[model samples]
Target: MSKAHLPTPPDFLIKEFASFQPKDRQAIAIKVAKLERKVFPAIEHFNYDVELKKKNIGMVLAFKEDDTDTVVAYLVYQRMKRLVWLHKLCVLEQEREKGLGKRLIEFLRTQMEKGGCQIHLWVDSNRKPAMALYKSCGFQQIEYRPDYYGPGRAALKMELSIGE
Candidate 1:
């Protein structure tokens, strides 16, 4: 998809993941891990430590309730050289279709632009919603691999350039 086709997200609050409160972090982790298990059971899960140690890892989180700070969405990416690799993006099942995912992508794009980075991500071809989301966020499918996850499962490699 072209950059002009992407939809602009509505107003939303996104904050760098700095709340070290164990409970808060654990809560977000649990939700993300659970969703990952449900959506991609065959994939290896990323523990908090492993995720945080990636080169230039940046985590942005979105809250459902302003007063309570309950995490409902998150985007995790790692910057290496001039490229930003999107590691994970998750939104609570109940909160889908509310544009939280797009908001997370926008936040990531803003950060990457500041550093003149291009974005890369891989998604299962069968995951229509995720594929659509990435395409709508200006990622072009650059490659396709059959059986990427396993037999009968294909993956699409997508890329988005934020700057030269």
Candidate 2:
């Protein structure tokens, strides 16, 4: 059997996942679990709605590979009182380092530019590459939570001020 070919650049779309169906939610859960294994094995399960609402959020962006029409990654965020919060983000392993994550962040920042809001994301303290990417994209470390994710995992809060 041949493996499915992923979509190429300039042919994908970013969609908002407003109401995830049972199947869609299951798929997302499985993918998130896989990612946790690689980056945050200690967190057994993640409550989607809790994360979605806790940060005063609104929408979740799903990057859909056009050719295959599959959601390869997702970014959950919220805007509150002139501040934007990126609650969670994850890219499929095959899609990493291809500039997709940066593109999503840039898109959000562009939207924030009109509103004059600052953007922030919470990254696992051990994710050095992600930290570097955020810093390279002009985000600065603003706060740290020791064992914020548990006894071993820490949370590093990074922010980018835009339209100020």
C-alpha RMSD by candidate, in order: 5.4, 6.6
Model 1 C-alpha lDDT per residue in residues 76-102, reported as the tens digit of each score = 888798988897888878778888888
Model 1, which residues run further than 4 Å from truth? 1-12, 19-39, 67-69
Off by over 4 Å in 2: 1-9, 18-46, 49-56, 60-65
Give the TM-score of each candidate: 0.80, 0.70
lDDT of 2 by residue, 54-127 (tens): 53554444455454335566566788878888866667778788776776676666667775888888888888
lDDT top scorer = 1
Candidate 2, poorest ten consecutive residues by summed lDDT: 1-10
* Steric collisions counted per model: 0, 1
As a whole number from 0 to 100, the lDDT of residue 22 in candidate 1 is 52
The number of residue pairs in model 2 that clash at the backbone is 1
